[model samples]
Target: MTLPLSGLAFPPSREPSTRVPADLRKQGFGVRIAEQRDLGFMRALYETLRAEEMARVAWPEGARQSFLDSQFTLQHRHFTTQFQHAEFLVLEHRGQAVGRLYLLRESPRWLVIDIGLLPAWQGRGIGGALLRQLQRDAQGSHAQGLALHVRLDNGRAHALYVRLGFREQGGVEGLHQRMHWDVPTAVAQLNTA
Candidate 1:
């Protein structure tokens, strides 16, 4: 079932700055339901994510574009179809699309289907902030915890998850590994200690 936004402590809305500031990191970030018009930007963001890996492949320009296009299409279709109740949100900073976050609420635990930011927006703690907000939302709703799968090769993201208290669960699934953050247990441990 779809989780109602009214139940969560959603981010506050802010007026977009007229001129890009020197420190854009200080700007407030918010999220909104992604729309059809965002598909192009989202697709380009996906391409940026795979750029490094794609660079390693010695393929013609047209071939590379075609491959990314097909892969993105498949992924988008799969996510939309498989997680019908999930919220597909677009991360915005100063009213500009900076990233995307897909979340699915399954009674006991919330699943992070995907979360990614543009290269320019990375390393600014925005992703972590977004996750922290989600954690709070989950806790407020009395959910058990949050869960997600991280690519085996994504050490940076895996480290972030670990730092956020997510522990590796089960074995690897293909190229990804399952990880979970159990809120009740964590809270209990913290209380006891």
Candidate 2:
């Protein structure tokens, strides 16, 4: 199984698993702690997410796979080493793994390191539901807010973040824009309503 997106690798057997809440199940979604066993699935998913970008360069199959493998390894190592306390979560629709959500909990903010779904899983309201829940959790914990970066060309994701109340703070790196959704605003709206 190939994994989706570029992120940390968790050995399945060593970590405990968790089921989504009953409320989420009613929405046809589930969450579980990703396992080492899911690495293949995660890798495959990452490749799929990169397929379009890789196509632009049109590298030979061997070269493309090699490059992706190296980058994946580097990223996974960086994330795991840097954010030792982050949660490596697998997103499931119904019962099958469809995406991954990597979250880093810090003192006053929760960093959404990555959140990507398979092509087939996009635009199904799953991402929205998950983000809303994360927002709620942030508010509950009195965190500053949630923050994430999206590639400049990833219009779909950027739009979703905006619709979820994230404001574009500025650009990051070369081709990414940093966006933030403030928990205080969310709490204020809820209090007013």
Candidate 3:
């Protein structure tokens, strides 16, 4: 069931049997939970998306830092306390921070509150690789589902999410779509194989 949110389409991820690339072994980058010191790089990644105009996104350049501060709060909590979810991530390639992926867990759903790669790091397979790892990494936690809101105008992310088996859950905040992918199925398949 999906709520009647404007500009939202309820697309759910494909079944666990859905074939995602078996390129898990092809590794070129590394990732880790972000720390307080890494916020600057994270912010830079956020700024990189301003040009996306993301159709449905309305973030002003001035508020990007504060916005990230609040979003990463839970992640900070996870650093000292125990949380069943991961809300902060920093992607590195060639020893340089190039992207950020912030998540928020909601029971059966994990919301990608923020996700963007710097311009210099775009066009590579980095984004897809990150999403794949995130899905695999999230398999045993919460409800084993990965969800995110994409600026309806974020056609690139929308297409990527779809390929990763994420489907719309029909809720919107301006131009974002509530997309989710079932984690357990993915985990189970990985485990069985």
Candidate with top TM-score is 2
Q: Per-model C-alpha lDDT, please?
A: 0.77, 0.77, 0.60
Candidate 3 on 1-193: residue-level lDDT in tens?
2212232221222222212234523444655566656755644555467544433457674465455455444333443244334445666665677776656556666666666788887777767876786676667554567777788877887898898898888768786778888866656576546
Tens digit per residue, CA lDDT, model 1, 31-86: 77777667887788999988888989999988888888778877887887788777
Error of 2 at 38 (Å): 1.0
Q: What is the C-alpha RMSD of each candidate to the true structure, in Å?
A: 8.6, 4.5, 11.1
Of candidate 1, the 10-residue stretch with the lowest lDDT total is: 1-10
Candidate 2 residue spans exceeding 4 A from truth: 1-24, 185-193
TM-score of each: 0.82, 0.83, 0.61
lDDT of 1 at 158: 96
Give me candidate 1's TM-score against the actual structure. Answer: 0.82
Better of 2 and 3 by lDDT: 2
Spell out the clash pairs found in candidate 1. none
- Model 3 residue runs over 4 Å out of place are 1-28, 54-85, 140-142, 184-193
State candidate 2's TM-score.
0.83
Task: Kindly indicate the candidate among 1 and 2 with the higher TM-score.
Answer: 2
